[model samples]
Target: MLEIENLHVTVDGKEILKGLSLKLNVGEVHAIMGPNGSGKSTLSYALAGRDGYEVTQGTMRFDGEDLRAMAPEARAAMGVFLAFQYPVEIPGVVTMNFLRTALNAQARARGEKEIDAAQFLKAARAAAKTLNISEEMLRRALNVGFSGGEKKRLEALQMAILKPRLAILDETDSGLDIDALKLVADGVNALRSPERAMLVITHYQRLLDYIVPDHVHILADGRIVKSGGAGLARELEAKGYDAVIRSAA
Candidate 1:
């Protein structure tokens, strides 16, 4: 469970999240739909404790702990995962190696026993298969020279393997065809459970068709202006962002 109150964040000295407040409870899937510059990604980064995205005001409480007090790795170990809109390419680090290291690191941070090589191999392969990631792909460099769909699937695979408590998916459906999108969405949907929560930040409603959210919120000017059930997502899809903002105004 994550609670944010009047969160104000600034990136490179320019404010992005302005008086934004959102609370994600266990077992709830919240979708944030907004046009560009509405601070959706900022909220994700602020929650992930990314460097340079400073919280100027407000408090973020994760699992009852002050989120700002913990390092980024600490947040991940606390079951927070952020799937970037544009996954960075890390050359030289094989996909399997990167995942193994990340998983082991998080486990060690949380006082859990490190997974042995055989266990990691079995788990990674299973998770990757759910995302349609082949063994060949996992042997390649991490997100290097991969297509957009490949990158997104890889992100989903990471989430599946991590089994995060709160997953923040920042435009995971971006740059994908209908088929590819379905694959990625299915991977995301598989991770949904009563003990987990997800914040799906998407610009379009098509993604919602596959990964249905329990609540949909319209974020504008760095704050959530409206909240509704699944019907709201279809309304925005039919009317567009400008219409929604005008109506909210």
Candidate 2:
């Protein structure tokens, strides 16, 4: 569903992603395992068309459409979702309201009818329950004063409600305890569908143990150095990033 070719990205005039290429098909979950500065997050931001992460060279296409030409909101309306590594706190916006607004905005942008309050409430409550989010949490301002686990769970809840065609999870496992990680991973795994694809960017194989990506890639030096099946993640776990990249080299 997504194809990138020799993508070179520059952030603030410094090149971070150099000649990177990847392809993800529908119904596949791909895991990108890389050390710090490997351009994992850069890939996600570039795919999502985040401002300031300029694509200096190469092309990114989603479902045969030129992704670079679309704005972030347009991309969201086109079913691209990026779950941030650090979810920001939005004070004074109730979590439920924020989800409803975002969902309806995407619907409107896609020329679909808006979801009424009762329908949205039912969907949100069901998703929140699956993610173990409490009713009180939904009533509170989005991510305000929440713990790391709470913030991550909220991100998962957003993903569940958004139901993007392509989900790019940028280090969603960071700062999450084992229990919290399991909850978040379960929520992610539940959304896996034949019509959906997920790009899971993470530092550790622990997340992969739960998500179980169809393909595992080792990204290093702003490029993907090695790509393999799920076993590659376990190998990386045993040998470490330096050793794995060295072996790939």
Q: How far is candidate 2 from the true structure (C-alpha RMSD, Å)?
A: 0.7
User: lDDT tens string, model 2, 158-232?
Assistant: 999999999999999999999999999999999999999999999999999999999999999889999999999
Candidate 1 lDDT, 213-249, residue by residue in tens? 9999999999999999999999999999999889998
Q: How many residue pairs clash in all the candidates, one count each?
A: 0, 0
- Each model's TM-score, in the order given? 0.98, 0.98
Candidate 2 colliding pairs = none
Q: What is the number of residue pairs that collide in model 2? A: 0
TM-score of 1: 0.98
How far out, in Å, is residue 21 in model 1?
A: 0.6
Q: Measured by TM-score, how close is model 2 to the native structure?
A: 0.98
Give the runs in model 1 whose Cα sits over 4 Å from its true position: none
Candidate 2 lDDT at 91 equals 96
